[model samples]
Target: MAHELIYMDNSATSPVDEEVLKEMLPYFNEKFGNASTLYRLGVDAKKALDKARQQVADLINADVDEITFTSGGTESDNMAIKGVALSEIQKATDKNPRNHIITTTIEHPAVLETCKFLEKFGFEVTYLPVDEDGLISLDDLENAIKESTILITIMHSNNEIGTIQPTKEIGEIARKHNVLFHSDAVQSAGKIPVDVKDQNIDILSLSGHKINGPKGIGAIYIKKGVRFEVFMHGGGQEKGLRSGTENMPGIVGLGKAAELARENLETRMQHNKEIRDALIEKVTSQIKDAYVNGSLEKRLPNNVHFRFSGIEGESLILRLDNEGIDGATGSACSTHDLKGSHVLAAIGVKPALSHGSLRLSIGPENSIDDVDYIVASIKKVVDYLRELSPLWDNETDEYIGDRFEKPLEDEDIDRY
Candidate 1:
């Protein structure tokens, strides 16, 4: 019999919830209409769009008017960063040209790449480094802020290592400095409590697929008083902030998902945490040189990151795939990059050790039995890979094979 697939990559994306799907089906055909029109069909769509906007706002405890739907997290992030930067640039003066952004080294590529793009236009960015547990120093963030700093765009929780930042504290600092704070909550929104008012956040971004909603849908929250230029301009959709024909089906799905997530947030978090903790305990106890990444106390309920010596993360993932387990080495967004994880590097992990990492993000569907099966499969695969690795000596836990006996000469390094 074929083994049943055990999915552990929820951080990458999740299966759309059945309830969310049910809520979306009608919009594809029966209720399909442009939300900007005044006819009955369009009026219904407009109602749905408003409800979804409110649902998304409730997830972060924001006013409904503050929410604006977007294509996805990337677009929302771009809009937040660029919208604010462009607005600041337009209002720049000789004495107060706010072109500086503050972010951490462990942020998702969505935020990092956006910051890099702004650098081309003479924007100065301060990428703060994190510690071994993938957490930033508040002092470092405070020290990085200057008179010219306009925005602090940090991620709420890291997608790779699952380290949750002190967003409230960061927000307080930004508020004190009179700087706008934007958090990429794409990974943390539904799974954790994200209260924009309580956290003192000015702008926030979240995705649909991460919370068991349809892909190609997301929402951005901008506090009422926070002003950024409109990101998109068209026939005046989304209150003229984001202008385009609304994705009716996707928006409905995201709305239903948000509603369900809010209603069952505690139950979902508890279940995921149970399975996540079990997997962590069993895997570390069963496998040698298995170290957990990020801070356990401040991590997401569903994230379990581990670094196993002697085996490449790609090999581990492939081996686990054969056994019906889905896992990841780093961010799904950066899997094709081939370089060692910048996230691991930021947390002080060596490139050699960073190569042997795995990220297993649990979901409500996972159970304790799934954790046991994953632990056994990983131990078996890691043992097999370590035996074949020239860099790993099982007995001594050191590299002592013939391959390591002699140092490569200048000419010997070019063979590969």
Candidate 2:
């Protein structure tokens, strides 16, 4: 087994940076105060909040007042989607009852579930289809818009496959139709360039944990004058968008992380991309039947997704973990679902192939020196797994047994 643990599951969460931690330490003890109050402690906390808000806003090229703190990406997504849905419902008249929302089939569960929840309340949601490369058609977007279409909510990049969408074009289409455009930028904010004004985005969501900051803290960018109802009630914190006492330490850490991310964006992008490409090239060239899942050219700098025939993703992850290399089968949030990834399904990957998918999301801590070990370990594990797999045909190098047809029997569990 490898001695050092190599973390390649950054899309799940990244470790807090030392600088971020340093910035957060004082907030927990010395600077602890209610941001809503007027005392000295409160004033200090309020100043930190304002500074943090500006830090987050600067990362995405938005005005400071446009940023609102939230619990995390889920709350931010909910705020953008359901908040708009509820607000539109309130403004509905006899003739102009705008109740439609447009989103992609490959969006994160936060957006997907929120859209489903609104569907329960008589709201219409159009889940757009993506191409095999995980890109939506701009024409399809424009054609789907109707008089009742109120909002277009799409993710900047897929969390699982890391396929970037044409967000700028999508935003233009939304604006041309006079519909609000919102993007779940939780995965793309720190890893890529996300200019709300340049991208024509009306609302955006980002999380802290994904960007080397503290967890349970996030921020959303809502363009000035964009209408959305208050999702969280009480205290009127976050300018009445979200409520409850502010998590000062978390906010501070996030602000620091955002500042670092903005300052190091170019370096981060270049380093991650180099490492990502090396891993992809090494793995694909060395391993047979290893297919990349998304568009390599349009992919995120840190993302590398591959599917190997005749091997289960869970087994691959476990074997990789034993080799001191951590990876993921898909989104960490949906790993418990026990179903094939919706993103893979949307991109036309076969169900059996989807079961073999592995996502190795790189981070700043990972270096190119780690690539050979990762590829070698993966090749060895794949060989061992395939040798034992009844599904695999060694001579033909193909998957013979169908997973759907042959469910795990009692004997199979006993063998393990």
Candidate 3:
């Protein structure tokens, strides 16, 4: 085994920052108290919670009262989508009920699955398509809106391809149409600038673990005066939007992470971009049959997703593991399924090539040396995998098209 591990999967999750952990330590022990309680200890806990809330709100340029703490990204997403849906459904009359929601095809499962669940309850949904660069067309979004459209939900940045959508434009369109707009900003919150007020976003979701904070902590920014129904019912915490005893430690960690992110956003972004661009330049130039997966110019600074023909992404990932480098084939949440990534499919990547896609997301911790090492390891792994692939034709030094055309066998799918 290698002596040191090189982690490059920040898109999936990040290690807690030392400062964030330090801030959280006190909450887990001496300051442990229910934020909902009325006693002195509880008052102290409430003060901490409120301060953390202000930190999170400041990071996004949202009012403190508009931020609602939640379990994580998924919970925040579910609450935003379901909360809006539930509220709209309740206010609808049989004669003129608004039951429509518009979203992109490449959304995270939290948004997609919630929309899918709402479909069973007689809600109409429009799943907009993305272009080859994994970006949805503004025209498509504008056309999707209807008189009954209640919400327009889209992600600020893709978790897999790292494409940054035109959220400000989308927000403008939603505002003009009088529709509530929500964005899953989990992937973009700390790494990029997210101003809810300026963007005209009514609701936004973000997670702690995505930004070097502890897991199981996140927040949803619901614009004050927006008509949204409650998600969880108990204790009447979070202004009755999300109700339960708060995870004080995780909240404090998230606050510290947010504060740090705001303070060093420019430096952090520059560091990530330097490493990411270097890796992309080296890998694409040095490796054979390689292609970058998303819009290179309009993508997240920390993300580098690419595809190498005639090799399986999972196989490549495992080989990299042996070299002490960690990465991912796609969204960590969708790894269990053997089918091609939905984001790749939405972007028109061939199913065969989709299986060969790899995502390397760098964080502030990664250095120039780390980027060089990652590129070198990837080149070796891809070449080795291609040499062993049955689809590779040694005679022509090319991939066999017919072999790729073959459908995946059920047994083969199960192995992955």
Off by over 4 Å in 3: 1-3, 406-416
lDDT of 1 by residue, 3-41 (tens): 699999999999999989999999999999988889999
What TM-score number comes out for model 1? Answer: 0.95
TM-score per prediction, in order, is 0.95, 0.96, 0.96
Clash count for each candidate, listed in order shown? 0, 0, 0
- Give the alpha-carbon lDDT of every model: 0.89, 0.91, 0.90
TM-score ranking from best candidate downward:
3, 2, 1
- Residue 193, candidate 2: how far off, in angstroms? 0.6
CA error at residue 185 for candidate 2, angstroms:
0.3
Q: TM-score of model 3 relative to the true fold?
A: 0.96
User: Any idea what lDDT model 3 has?
Assistant: 0.90
What C-alpha lDDT does candidate 1 achieve relative to the native structure?
A: 0.89
- Candidate 2 backbone overlaps, count: 0
Clashes of 3: 0
Itemize residue pairs with steric clashes in candidate 1: none
